[model samples]
Target: MERLTLSVTIDRPIGYDHHGTIYPINYGYVAGVIGGDGEAQDVYVLTEDDKPLESFTGELIAVVHRGDDVETKWVVTDFDVSYTADEIMATVRFMEQYFKSTIEMVD
Candidate 1:
């Protein structure tokens, strides 16, 4: 398990999935980290709270690698939420299902 401590800011809140599907978690990106997509690394902030945030400093617990997509997403948590690879996949399946993905667990 590779546990990474990093900081991120949330741009997406719990709401519709742009396609009208409800998002159960917050999603955003690390401020300065760049990813394969040439942007700040994308991240999923797994929390049940409805509050939206501009920024959050937290930990990167895993990386979601998509076989069909050009981008990899970092899974981060601002609070005390944790999940196994399987559990994480299930939670983000709403959108991730469109792409073949594997979760690389971190400490």
Candidate 2:
């Protein structure tokens, strides 16, 4: 099995809102191939205040076997917070950077 791990650190604080409450948050996403096949699976971890809150596993968000590349984009939002696109993009970029740094292997 081929495994990849990516992580990023952000100077800005990160937080999440759930059930009318806001809390510090940390998150990580990982994707990789198995048995040298083209298909891939992904896992997403969401942590609040340094504790695990939720985890989701599913098929890869985007896959390109021929090109030997895969990409995943997650849009996390809190309707109550009303963040703009720029704000969202900033968060996404943070994740992107984190993933780029943390990835251990890709195939």
Which of the numbered candidates is closest to the native, going by highest TM-score?
A: 1
lDDT tens digits, residue span 27-73, model 2 = 43333432233433222332223553344332222221222335443
Question: Against the true structure, candidate 2 has what lDDT?
Answer: 0.33
Per-residue C-alpha lDDT of model 1 across residues 1-107, encoded as one tens digit per residue = 46777777777776736767777778888877888989888998875556766777777888999998889999887556777899899989987999999999886
| RMSD, every candidate, angstroms | 2.0, 12.3
After aligning candidate 2 to the native by TM-score, how far in Å is the CA of 99 from where it should be?
8.8
Q: What is the Å distance of residue 51 in model 2 from its true position?
A: 6.5
User: Using Cα atoms with residue i matched to residue i, what is each candidate's TM-score against the true structure?
Assistant: 0.85, 0.29
CA lDDT, candidate 1, residue 15: 73
